[model samples]
Target: MSKKALYIRHKAQPGKREEVKRIWEKYARAYIEDADGQIAYVYGFDDTDPDAIVAYQFYDGEAGKEDFVKQPWYPDYERETAALLAGPSEFRTITPQWIKGGAA
Candidate 1:
C-alpha cells in the first residue's frame, strides 16, 4: 500500500505559539520518532504567519496513521492542544507520488 501523509495547519491563540510548540514537543515529538511504520514528521511555524503552527507527517499506510492517533494518550493531547488553539485546525491527507529526502 502507498504511504499516507498528513498536513496540519493550526492557529494558536494570540501569544500562545510557543506554548503550543512546547505542548507538542512534550506530547508527540519523541513518540513520532520511534513509532513503527511512521516515515517522518515535521513541526514548524508558518513563514508568513507567526501564530500558525504547521505539521507534516508521513506514515507507512492509513493504519499506521490511525494507530498513532488511537493511542491512549491521544485524548490528552487533543484536549491540551485544543485549549491553546484559536480555532479548529485544518487537516489534509496526501498520497505520495514521488520520493524525497527524509523529514528533518
Candidate 2:
C-alpha cells in the first residue's frame, strides 16, 4: 500500500506565531518519542506569511494514519493549540509520489 500523508495549514492568532511554533516543537518531540508508523514529519512557517504555519506528516499507510489520529495525545494537542489559532485549520490527505532531497 502507498504511504498516506496529511498536510495542515495553521494561521496563528496575532502575536502568537512564536507560541505556535513552540507548541508544535514540543508536540513533535513528544510525538516522535511516543508514536509509531510515522514515515516523516516536517513543519515550517510560510515564506510570505510569518503567521502561517504548515506541517506535512507522512505515515506508513492508511491504517497508520488512523492509528495516529486515534492516539490519546491527539485530542490533547488540539485542545492545547486551539486558543493560539486564528481560525480552523486547513487539512489535506495525500499520496506521496516522490520525495527528493531533504526539505530546505
Candidate 3:
C-alpha cells in the first residue's frame, strides 16, 4: 500500500514566514530528489492568510518515510528550522488506496 503525508504549518509569528519558506527551500532538493519513497510534493500559502502554508507530500510506503526521516540531513533540517517555527506543526499519514496522479 502506498502512503502519504499531509503537513500543515501555521505561522503565528508575523515576520517569520519568509524564513520558514527559505528553510523549506534549502532542504527541498534533498527531500524531493534524494529521499526514499518520496512520490510528490506540493506546498503553498493561504491567500487570505500568508502565515499559513500547507504541504502535501506522498511517499511510496511507511517504511520509505521512516527511512527518509532517518537520513542525516533530515535531522539537520529539523534542528535548523525548529527555532524559526511557531507552535507545534501537524503531520498526518495517509494510505493512498488510489491516487490519480502520475507516479514518481
Could you estimate the TM-score for every candidate?
Answer: 0.91, 0.80, 0.76
Q: Model 1, 1-104: lDDT tens per residue?
A: 67888999999998899999988888888788889878878899999998999999888888778987888888888899999999999999998877686432
lDDT of each: 0.87, 0.78, 0.69
Query: Which pairs clash inside model 3?
Result: none
Model 3 clashes, total count: 0
> Candidate 2 lDDT, tens digit per residue, 1-104?
66778999999998788898876666655765465677777888888997898988877778766876676677877777888999999999987677666231
Residue 30 accuracy (lDDT) in model 3? 57
Clashing pairs in 2: none
Q: Which stretches of candidate 3 lie over 4 Å from their true place?
A: 10-12, 101-104
**What TM value does model 3 have?**
0.76
Q: Specify the highest-TM-score model's number.
A: 1
- Quote the lDDT for 16 in model 3: 76
Model 3 poorest ten-residue lDDT run: 4-13
Q: After superposition, how far is residue 45 of candidate 2 from its true place, in Å?
A: 1.0
